[model samples]
Target: MIKLYGMTGSGNCWKPAVLMKQLGQPFEWTEINTLKGETRTPEFLALNANGRVPLLIVNGRKLAESNAMLCYLADGTDYFPADRWQRAKILEWMFFEQYSHEPYIATVRFWVHFMQKQEEWKDKIAEAMKKGHAALGVMEQQLQKTSFLAGARYSIADIALYAYTHVAHEGGYDLNAYPAINDWMKRLEAQPKFEKMTG
Candidate 1:
């Protein structure tokens, strides 16, 4: 069985959980309470020196990084593309997701919803959100033109961004301005095997 260490509400963690449900794969979830410093402990640190959640332990070997794990589990599955160029395109979007998208989107959620009254990050929070919406604007532009991010078909790229984007409001970004993004989000939610991140 695959064992996953992640916080339930995290977009990165939700990536695998959502994929498992969509693919009908069997797995066990062990939520790592980062708020309690569970991920920083010796045992957890051994799994990932970065001390991040969403670690996938398969057959005693651990894989870190949420998007990387998504690629691993999704290989040869419907979520993965068979065409090399298309696969490359998917990777491009995945890279953009981690670099351009996650920093802002995830940070906003962390600051606004999760961090709460932690004044330490208040300034960074406000700054991240402004950048976050700009990132969403990129998505809105792509969603306006293309049905999905990578190819004409739905792929892991959609799943990669969907986790945080769907809940972007929690980060204080208004979705009403991006009708195309909202429509695309609704389409993803309407998929036959779609799964929600909130447990």
Candidate 2:
């Protein structure tokens, strides 16, 4: 069986979990408390040089990075488009999720919710909220016309973005303002075998 080392509440960690569940793939989960310095331990670092959770161990080979793991698992699956243009578009959104979305949205969530440093990190949190909303605005514009990020079909791109976006409220970004994004999220949730970020 595949082994996934991750923290349950982490959106990055939640990415592959949701995808695997939707794909009906069985895997074992080993929770890693990153805040407790578990990821920095020699044992964990031996598995992941970056000392990050959401590591995938398959057949004794380790794979780190959440979006990369999603691509590996979704390859040749329905969630991964076969068409060249469609696949490229999916990759585009996935890249945007990492470069544009997660940096602000996920970071704010880590600070405000997980670290409970909303008061301490007030300035940083406020700045992150601005950038996070900008990212959501970009998403809202795309979702206004298409049902999914990678065009008309549901794909890994949606999964990548949804991982953090669905929980953006935890980061103090309001969802009610993005109607298109809201509806698109509903569409994703209605997909077969869908599961929430946390257990």
Candidate 3:
């Protein structure tokens, strides 16, 4: 069995949780309240030097970074591509999600959903939202050309970005304006094994 340390509502953490259930794997989940600095403690730091949520403890090995875990768990699974070029494309999207998508999407989600844009984060929300929209546009353009991020098949590349793109509206980015993303979201939702982060 695997053990996972996560915050209840975190998009990064939710990625593995949803995938585990979708994959029919059994794992233990320990909720860590990041708002209370639970992850910064020495105990958690030993697990992940970065002190981040979405830590995966499998076979006594601990790993951090949500996208990394997605790739790790997907070994020998359909979510992992068999072809070298397709596999590279999957990794490409995973890297894109971390560098280009999460900063804006997750940050804006924090302001709109949790803080209500009430603090110093307020001044930067608009700009962040703009970048977030641009990131979605990048996904939209790819999705329009291909059925999935890598190709026709669903892969961890989809899982990586799907972690937050589904709820980008929580960040005040309108999905209605993105027909391709909206359509893609529905397709993901329609997967028979689909599991949602929030009830």
Residues 1-199, candidate 3: write the lDDT tens digits. Answer: 8999998878899988878877898999999988899999999998989989989999999899998898888877888967889899999999999999999998889787876764667769887878888999999999898888888988888888988898787777778877888788788877768876782
lDDT of 1 at 172: 76
The candidate that wins on lDDT is 2
TM-score of every candidate relative to the true structure:
0.94, 0.97, 0.95
Q: List residue ranges in candidate 2 displaced over 4 A.
A: none
Error of 2 at 116 (Å): 1.6
- Each model's lDDT: 0.86, 0.91, 0.86
Winner on TM-score between 1 and 2 is 2
Highest TM-score against the true fold, candidate: 2
- Let me know the TM-score candidate 1 reaches against the reference structure: 0.94
RMSD, one per candidate, in order: 1.6, 1.0, 1.3
List clash counts for every candidate, in order: 0, 0, 0
Model 2 global lDDT (CA atoms, 0 to 1) = 0.91
lDDT of 3 at 94: 94
* Model 1 weakest lDDT span, ten residues long: 117-126
